[model samples]
Target: GLRVLDNLPAPSLPCEQDRLRDFMGRRERGELLIQKINKLQEKLLKKMQLSVSKDGFVHFGDTVMLLNPDSKSSVKNCPGACVRLTLAINLDEISIYSFKSLEAPCGVSAVESVDPVARNTFCILSVDGAPASEPIRFGQKFSLGTTGGASDRMLYLASDHKSFIRFAKKSHLQQVFLTDELSYLTCWQAAFLDPQLRLEHEGFPVP
Candidate 1:
C-alpha cells in the first residue's frame, strides 16, 4: 500500500496544470481583443477627419476637379478635360486657385492653358429659402472676388437640411447668379481621385 502511494502522482499537480492552461488561453484572447480594438480605432480616426465642424459647416479643402453635370461621361472619355480647382481655407478666409484648362505633355509636369488665377478671401453667405425658392437659393454661397465686388461665384455647398442632390442639377442654378458656371462646377456624381484627403482650418491636409 505504501509503495503504491509513493508511485502515484501528486494530487495538486493536475489542478496546477489546469490553472496554467486557463491563464494561457485568457492571455491569447486578451491579445486578440486588443488587436481588434486597435484596428477599429484606426478606421474611426480616418472617418473623423471629415466630420462636420462645430460651426455647423462642412468644410472642404482639397484638390477638387470641377466637372460638368455630365461628369461621368466626360471623365470616362477624357479625364484631362476635367478642370482642377485648388482651395485654400484658413477657417477665417477662403482662397481659390483656378486655371483655365489642364495640359499634360508626355505625362510630365502638366501646364495650364491660362495663368492660374488666385482669388482673395471669399465671403460666405447663407440665404434662407422662400416657399417657392429652389434648394440652391437656400444654400451657402462663396462670393467670387470681383473688381466691383459683383459677387458672381455661387458654388453651392450642401446645406444642413438639404441633401447634396440639389447642387448636382444644372437646372437648379438656372436663376442663380453664375457668371462662369463651368469654372465653379462641382458634379455630385463625379469620381475624385483621392477624396479622403481633408484640410484643417489651418490650411493644411489632415494626416
Candidate 2:
C-alpha cells in the first residue's frame, strides 16, 4: 500500500537576504571610497603642481623659488638705525635667468638643445606658459650622432650675444647656428630644467 505524502518546501534562512543586502551595501561603499581617493589624489597633485618628465625628472613651478633659503633676509634695528642683511644670493648661481623676474615664453610646445662630442648631453624643455625662468645647463656634452644627420646640427644659444658669438667661434660653427630659442620657452619650464640640472650634478633626486 502506498501512502500519499505531501512535499515539504525547503526552509529559507532569514539572514540570507540580509547578508546579500549587506554585501551590496559594502560594495557600493567601496566604490564611493575609491572615487573619493581618486579625487583627493588629483587635488593634491594639482595643488603641488607636480609633473614628471619622460626622463624621470620631476618638476614644480615657481613655488620652488619661495622655498629658497638664500632668498631670506634679516633686518636689524638699533635705536633709529636700521640695517638690512640681504643674504640673498645672486639668482644666476641658482637659476638660469639673465635677470630677476624674467620668465620663459608662452604658447610653446617643445624645445631641445644638445651639445655633442664632449659628454653627450641633451636637454628638452616643455612648457605651457608659466611665469618662471631658469636656465638648464648640461654638465656633459651630448652626442649628435653622425655629421650629416639632422641631429648633428643643433642650434646653440647663450644668455648674451657675446657668449653666443664666442661659443660659435669656439665650436668653429656658423653664427647662424645660434638662435634665441629661450625667448619662446616659458618661465616654468626654464626654472624646472635649471634646477633639474643642478640637482643632477649634485647627485640628488630630480624630484
Candidate 3:
C-alpha cells in the first residue's frame, strides 16, 4: 500500500541513534583504558627486573632458589630482601631464588628446602577464576591453587585474615596480591585503596 506514507512518525530513530552513539563512546573509552593498562603492565615488569620469555616462562640468569619459610626470617629485617623465579626453556623445570639480600655482595644461605615435587601439585589461576591459559606478567592478578584436589578445597593466600593464607571454598577464592618492593614484586597488598576505583583494599585487586 503506497498510500502517502511519508508522514508516519519514525519515533524510534532518535532513541536508536542515541543508543548506538553511547555504545561507540563506551567502546572508545574501554579501548583507551586497555592501552593504559598495557603500559602499566610494561612499567611494572621493568620495575620488577624480570625477563619473561615469549612462551610465558620466566628467565633467571642463574638457578632459582626455593627458600624455606624458617630461613626467610634471617633476612626479614635485613634491607632489600628479594626473591626471584626462573623457568626452564622446555617448561619442565622451574627454579626459585629466595631471601637474597640487596646489600650483601654474596648469596645468603637458606635452610630446610621444601620438597620440589610440591611444584607439580599447584597451578596458577587468572583473575577471572579460570586456569591461567596465558603466561603471567606484571599488572595482572593471579591465585595459586592445587591442580587436582577437590575444586572447592583449593588454598589461596589471604593477606588480611589472621592467617596469612586461607583456603578457597566452592564459590570463593582468597587471593594473594603483588606489590612493588624495592624493584621486586613482593606478595603484599596496599595499606589504602584508591577512592576512585571503589574497590575495598582487601581481597579485590590481586596486584
Q: Best-fitting candidate, measured by TM-score?
A: 3
- Write candidate 1's Cα lDDT for 62-151 as tens digits: 212222233567677877664443221111111111211111110111122222222212222222221211122112332221111122
lDDT of candidate 1 at residue 116, scale 0 to 100: 23
lDDT value, residue 13 of candidate 2: 75
Whole-model lDDT values for every prediction: 0.29, 0.29, 0.33
In the range 1-207, model 2's lDDT, one tens digit per residue, is 998767876667767888888878867775445554443333212322212354554332211211112222322233432332211112222223211121221111111211121111223332433222332233321111111112233322222234443433433443212232534211222222566456555533344
Give candidate 3 misplaced runs (Cα > 4 Å).
1-111, 118-121, 129-131, 147-152, 161-207
Candidate 3 C-alpha lDDT tens digits along 7-44: 87768988999999987886777544555444333322
Query: Where is model 1 more than 4 Å wrong at Cα?
Result: 1-74, 86-121, 126-207
| Clashing residue pairs, backbone N/CA/C < 3 A, model 3 | 64-96, 65-96, 65-97
Q: Clashing residue pairs in candidate 1, if any?
A: none
Which structure is stronger by TM-score: 2 or 3?
A: 3
TM-score, predicted candidate 3 vs. hidden true structure: 0.26
TM, every model: 0.19, 0.19, 0.26
Residue-level lDDT for 45 in candidate 1 = 24
